[model samples]
Target: MTRDNDTERRRPDVRTSLDQWLDSRRGVLRKGIAASTAFTLGASAATGAASAQQDAPFGAVEFQNQTSDGTTVVVDSAILERGGFVTIHDGRLFEGQVTGSVIGVSDYVEPGGADHLTIDLFDVPGAQFDQSQLQNTQPLVAMPH
Candidate 1:
């Protein structure tokens, strides 16, 4: 007979730590966003050159080191560093615009979690990503090359 020991126990299948947090705090996140958006603080002023894309246009992105640091990373807008395109050592080929700015991470669950958060660093003029369904996401400290 097969004995179900601690070493043989199967853990729940959770794709990512970020997903876990989202399932637990769905209401809080939605409400928070609504409340914050409702209270417009400042007027829509003209953004300076600093907010502009400072590097070679990205044709795609491959996330490296995608993990959750017990905090939520909201996909607001890109706060790009005014520089050149970053290349990834072994980054997966992504084809689209990148989202999110918050960078926080704990550790990725190796067995069933992502390895890294890498973004393609190519030059794609008139490229943009659709982020209509973007919500609270797992914190990641990914670096693209």
Candidate 2:
């Protein structure tokens, strides 16, 4: 009977200790969940900010050309001054050219963004302009925009 009374006396202390351990574990778990949630929200905010910046508009270029064969070449801002010339598998290529009465064959100026140049040509003699002729040719400006 004495032994039973002693065990009964210790029951409340054991229960209190177990309860404190569980509460401590729950606090750690809550902190972990909070940290994870904060990290996720921060990453989402950064991605949203980057996407908004990318959505802003940039510079563009336009090209207008007329060939002697009566074929009009109207290249949009994307195709004009694309760093290199357009080439075909058969070895035919056309680079940006500048000449009198070429309509819109002039160096491009981006102003704030990247600088690019667009040279429009009119009345090209042959079926197409020779790509090799533009090789190692430097533009009037250093930036070529």
Highest TM-score: give the candidate number.
Answer: 2
> Tens-digit lDDT track for model 1 on 1-145?
3565653556555666656765664543433333222222112223433333332222222343343332222222222222222222111112112222312222222222232333322222343333322234422323321
Candidate 1 lDDT at 58 equals 26
lDDT per residue (tens digit) for residues 22-105 in model 2: 578454334333332343244456667566434423323232332322222333333212232211111121132212112223
> Which one wins on lDDT?
2
Stretches of candidate 2 exceeding 4 Å from the true structure? 1-53, 68-131, 134-145
The lDDT, on a scale of 0 to 1, for candidate 2 is 0.33
Pairs clashing in candidate 2? 105-120, 108-117, 108-145, 116-145
The alpha-carbon deviation from the true structure for residue 5 of candidate 2, after best TM-score superposition, in angstroms, is: 84
